[model samples]
Target chain A: MKLAYAIPAAGIAALTSAYASAETITIATVNNNDMVIMQELSDRFEEEHPDIELDWVVLEENVLRQRVTNDIATEGGQFDVMTIGTYEAPMWGERGWLEPLDDLPEDYQVDDLIKPVRDGLSHDGVLQALPFYAESSMMYYRTDLFEEHGIEMPDQPTWSEVRDWAEQLHDPDNDLAGICLRGKPGWGENMAFVSTLVNTFGGRWFDEDWNPELNSEEWQTAIEFYVELLGEYGPPGASSNGFNENQALFSSGKCAMWVDATSAAGRIYNPDESSVADDLGFAPAPVAETPKGSHWLWSWALAIPATSESKEAAKTFITWATSQEYVELVGEEEGWTSVPPGTRESTYANEKYQEAAPFADFVLNAIREADPTDSTLEPNPYLGVQFVGIPEFQSIGTQVGQQIAAALTGDRSVEDALNAVQRSVERDMERAGYLD
Target chain B: MSAVQTKRPWVGVLAWVIALIIFFPILWMVLTGFKTEADAIASPSLFFTPTLESYVEVQGRADYPKHAFNSITISLASTLLALLIAIPSAYAMAFLPTKRTKATLLWMLSTKMLPPVGVLMPIYLLSRDLGLLDTRTGLTIVYTMMNLPIVVWMLYTFFKDLPRDILEAGRMDGANTFQEVTLLLLPLSMPGIASTGLLSIILSWNEAFWSLNLTASKAAPLTAYIASFSSPEGLFWAKLSAASTMAIAPILIFGWMTQKQMVRGLTFGAVK
Candidate 1:
């Protein structure tokens, strides 16, 4: 009787303790394809650790950013996990708003992360967020179209060469355009591609002492080149086509070339998702004066705010979600074509992934070659290749972007738009106390 | 009367044109919900083989019933609470006037002018302090506060339009103040009250800012559900349309079923 009572008592204590310690951690994320996959595969995480329950707040990008920024700034403790991007991770981490994630377990092999990706989310040489998916801008072309046109594509093309090729490939009568580039005006929309264009043209957003450089020769040349190229050969209403619109255009065989993020490669490579998947060809983004910052680097990373009460659980979840084993799980379950790309070397080394994604090595190289710290040909104060990496950059970049759109639309002259951009950017800098 | 008859047929055709123009976007959404992702971004066309894939996927991915429940309960509960508070206040303001009445009314309406973002931090902190963050009770309270001004203004107008003689006669018949107001004022202005309540419910149901900011997983309404279907980096038009269709179905159905009373109540004071 004593033995049986003791056994039952111990069992009850263990069960009750387990139930009592169960922590419900709320994870706030943006509604991206990779995030959706993570949410779907999180059941595996639950099975591994039954002592934690997950609550998700999947929102659109801007809403999620505002919501998380509000919560973090106020220390409201609403979300334990936040899905932030490279742009925010360093900015937030520098302010000590996020917990440093430098001490992940040995099995995680944090060194396996692509260096640029790892550095992109770090501040003060300490990791603050773990990358879930990363991308570098690249050029994708239609091999079939090139072959039919008897054009020999180069491994590394210059802007002049591209313009010449676009002249040959331009076929508006056949409903095929020469190229498609992001045109919608926003910091991350047209400005992302445009910044890379400016970088390769040896232009920088600011010089030393944070002086605005929109009046520079490089800026004028790059913007003029872009406007003329797209105006002559881009699709009708090219001003409204962002990444998705361009992808749809490319997928439907309406565009012969697209220069955009490498993340689209997976979708474009899938025969089910793209009609021209088999005929797709890719190369590094074109160069003009310099190759430094020829491509932009971006990543969507998972991080924990300092206000989280359940930091340990949030860390565990983020680590697992970005783990190599998780990559394998995604490959087996959701197919290798659907796996989150550009984060892990182990992913590239995986035979199945390599077999599934032919451009895996090329994408990995593009992501690795991107150096955010030393991106421009000239010395600059900011950290990003495509952006200035300040809170004020969003407003400034979008304003410049809108001005560029006005130039394209003939509402303003190129010189007039550049002058407006120069003045507004200087005003912004002065208000930001960056200039006297 | 002869002129009115001549204009009637032309007015009917014009009304249909206006209605269809207004309804076209929602109809487009409904049609897009049944298309494949490829078909959705192809071009706007009506003739495509309808598919249930997007609807099936959206419902399978999200907790539709729970979000619907939160939307219904929050909207109805908030409307009821607003009515409970506003009806008496409006009655007092309508039947009994004061020197600062106009100023008070203006001050109440001014709260609506300040953007919701201005108060986000304070309310978020307050919600945290009250331990009501992400709770339905918290959302209900915030939404009640959201719709109170309009509810009060609408009810005040409604009550002011009523002749004060009915309540005075009820009082003369030996009925108490509470009884006179409830028995006389509420019933006689039933259409106005019904319309105000319905409008309040619709406003609360359609509210996105407070609903998103105040609630997370547990009490997130259909706005959040619909928000989850959109992605800045991916193609999700078909899925987004499906989620939107389901999100608005409840209110749309409610409006359709009560169109008769809604039409009457909405047009109650227009002619007068």
Candidate 2:
């Protein structure tokens, strides 16, 4: 009996070590405000689920996308949970690289997630990822600056009216630029801002038949308008500026107005983060001929990789991260302004959050109103509002963005830039067999 | 000497101005680290409410020590491995004096001309196949391959500058092939070796592409850490500068301490 009991005990010890090895899960993510909060609060998660261990690979937006894309494509299995955007969730899910996350725990309140955010992050009605924060583009202006200048900014100011206001408020001598905008040449950098501008100007990347319309009169007008506005009133070295650069410009009270993501409302309102926290005024993204696609929709969501060996552990961590409890935890610890916004309806409906964040109602309204399906004035065959939802988009959009940057620098005419963009995009589309 | 030199105080002032011009960008980045993100980008000037907010945020954002640890491991490991491989190869080319040796050196250097992106796919697949992706050992191996040719060329020049008669005497003293090479050749080339190692470490530490591509969680270095501060919409100047300062601090201090050896190696054979 002693010999038999000793053999089984030895076997149990062997199994325990193997089980310990299996408990650790690695997650690849972007370094966003919410993700950073998750990293800090992970001790709570680890204590509650002591059987699971969390490993994080936090990278920048572009680098994270490239790393996650390479990992999933190669099936390297380096990370179990990947922080993806609304752009990648559907594409990667269609490629069978991501696992379906439909069977979340009942308490996760899957139905409580905002429908627009959830649907954008799903494919064929099967949820592929969970939203950490979703956002639509909106205008953030300095209320103090406007009030001091005796300027009245309507909630729905037209783009023409915005430009007039900017010109009126311009004071380069005061170290203040009338506006701040992205000028860095990347698909997601300057192109994100430019795409929304193009939409509002009644320009589409492609027509219904998938022919590139970059050289059209509408696109020319948009490019010219952007160049003129920035050249006249934007900060110096504008060609090198991207989102973070522009964010710094805006938050310092140097920018009279900025049009960017609703996700930034939290950061801009935090007293610890922004100098102009109390003086911020929110408005809808400005429009020209069309108001339909004046804003963009984006969700920075988390998904599990199909090749993950520790699937259960990964899923558990993601669920905890995107849970309603996590939102409340962030509010309690980091303040309500820093809480992950535009993801769940509960966040918007909470009186505590509404009272805490003055920009809450405007951000929610913008997010809810953004329609990705009809993001352009003309018909087109793409899903994203600020980006074309295809693998080749990274290459194509970047090429166009370079031309736009060149135009900004006066190295090329707006017409020449648009002409080059039209030719390159059309050639690429034809080569890719998207057009006959 | 008295009249011409005394008349030109403006020349010294111009020299100082030139030095300042060369150093401005780095000084700007350092100064930006102390400012809040808002102030850093808004004015691009020295006037602002200086804050440690970005540094605080940067430290909390990621494990700086872990990344610094990986950087130290991979850079030192790769430099040592490359030295072991290149010293012998360079010795053969320098002392052995074959007609094909010059061609071989040229061929080795030519490999550096190929853009990293051109061969990224094959190398990435190979790393994956070998189960080396995201491992410190894997990065060391890749970095060794990447830095080998330059190491070989540098070591060869240093070895060539050594007195051939000293090596010949060691051979006559029955030092044997290994001893003559190890004891005599290595020590004589110490200045060169130190500088080469320093260069390799600096290059490997600053390399962003492979570290970003190969390593996700486990073996990420300071380059990837600095890169995480950049976002799509705009650049976070204060936080990025803070990350950059942290990333560059170790190597900068290392360089300062070993400046003598680096200068000796760089200026090797120049006087002779």
Candidate 3:
């Protein structure tokens, strides 16, 4: 009887002490380098709080999206903090699935966040997420090859000029593609690039009434031009190439020029990871007939789910991760270029960052100039530069990615591909109650 | 040299070619793991300076032994549980004729055909309700249920192949049902049972979907580990290959060591 009482007393004491000592919050994030750095330096956050613990679940972008979506929808409380993008923050926050991050401490410098990055993470003027790193698309080319061929790259090049340059640089005889672009069939994979191309060509996915306008004249011209350019001058099997594949090709000196996320600047400039690090040059993403949406903005941000039981603790961690102090810590600990970019104006203003990253000013301007709400040349209803800011956009854009691939592979004509996309997207919009 | 002897060398060459075709991807992955990130994407070279950069970085970022330990324990625990439940059911279906036995077996096999995503929500909710999410016990239970149908069918076939005379003799000698199954049927069908257990272990070890969805950090297996190395921002092929190499190394070695038993057991039911 005495032994049994002792066991019960010990169990009660252990449970109470464990419950009071620490509040562990789980964070689900992607495997990008910036997020990895956040995970690495979380120990600092733990040290500061002392009563909080951090657990991480790092997955690829698509996997993490699905996992976090399921958990938040079900109110499973599996993850306290979720690393999302501009694509998710607004839509989910509109549904009240995310906790509004209001009243952050003054030192957090909520005002220092770049406008586009901050606005993209808010729904109706309420900040719903804190950005970790933001990126905009741009053109990366081989300066050596440009000099050798006597080609002049414009400050803000147009598609026609880019086409002529691609033709001039075409050298299949020596295993070089004039240009490489994302051609993989996924919403975030190729659609991200293709949507910006459509925007610069003065195309919009929908009108103000939310009717899909995929078959507009501007879209046809853009798709036809895209098909002709990539089919004639792009790498063989371009349909299988995504951002990573294109990066690999360019860094290995197989592609004369490429266009992709500004975040890739660090990797492609790192001498250890890239062979063309010494010969690289960047330019604003090429425009086509209009320069309105030549570049697209995207960011990986952290937000607390409404289902989180430990909201206060989760807020503490996210605030620390997105603050200037955290940025300085990363700059000092992992070198200056490794600091998360495009989120804070201060990071771009830092001389240390400018000394390390030559493209800092250009990337900052690109991010600032990419206004998601007003990106299209013609007026449109969407709130994203490269995507329609509706949840249904994911499925709709994915199908369009495949349709574009079909055009590039010669399985469908440009007109035919756009027509198919137009019809399917109409059906989706109708079913989603947007058409009514 | 007779005809058989003359054909032996050619057959050996054909076998080698077929094996090489099947093994080429794994071989490429292992080789790429040792290359630098820059060299990895360069046009394939038969020879390059090997480095431990990727392996070192992967280990620094991820805790491999923790995931490996989870994989080992979950696979073994799930396999043992699946076998324990499968054997008696197989014995009952093979020995005692029931009207619904065939239907029951067919129905169990049909469960495997169901798309995992169809029931993912309910299963996740159930696991969460039971406080089993992200626990090794939860994963082990899921793996056991997933492998049960196949394990039962294999053992049933093996038991059917066994001569019923020995079991009848033991029964006549006053051995009870439990005694007869434990002492007689088990010893007789050891090869089939061993193969079923091994196959279950391999399947559970390489399982990705449920493991990824259910476990977050603590109980995640090597699938999650490999996934963390695949960056969306830029190329990290060498590190990804290193993680892939590490994930498959244990299973590859286990399969190789147990090749004889698996080959014998798989071929047993095929012939007299």
What tens-digit string does per-residue lDDT give for candidate 3 at B106-138?
999999999988989999999988988888999
lDDT of 1 by residue, B132-239 (tens): 888889999999999999999989998988988888888889999799778999998888888888888899889999989988887888898998899886679999
Q: Model 3, residue A109: what's the lDDT?
A: 93
lDDT tens digits, residue span B1-272, model 2: 55865899788789899999997887888889999865775646778777899999898777676677778778889999999999989889888989999999999999999998788788888999999988999999999999998999999999999999999999989998789899999988898998998899889989988888888866888897898787554337789999999888878877888899899989978896
Off by over 4 Å in 1: A1-21, B1-7
Q: Give lDDT tens digits, candidate 3, residues A134-243.
A: 99999999999999999888788888888899999989999899999989999898999999999999998899999999999999998888889889999999988999
Preferred candidate (TM-score higher): 1 or 2: 1
Clash count for candidate 1 is: 0
What would the per-residue lDDT of candidate 2 be over residues A48-67, giving only the tens digit for each residue?
99888777787777778888
Residue A60 in candidate 2, Cα distance off native in Å: 1.8
Q: What are the clash counts of all predictions, listed in order?
A: 0, 8, 0
Model 2 misplacement above 4 A:
A1-22, A144-151, B1-61, B169-176, B229-246
> Which DockQ-derived CAPRI band holds candidate 3?
acceptable
Best by lDDT: 3
Local accuracy of candidate 1 as per-residue lDDT tens digits, A120-201: 9999899989999999999999999899989887888898988888888999999998989988898989999999999999
Q: Score the docking of each candidate (DockQ).
A: 0.33, 0.24, 0.29
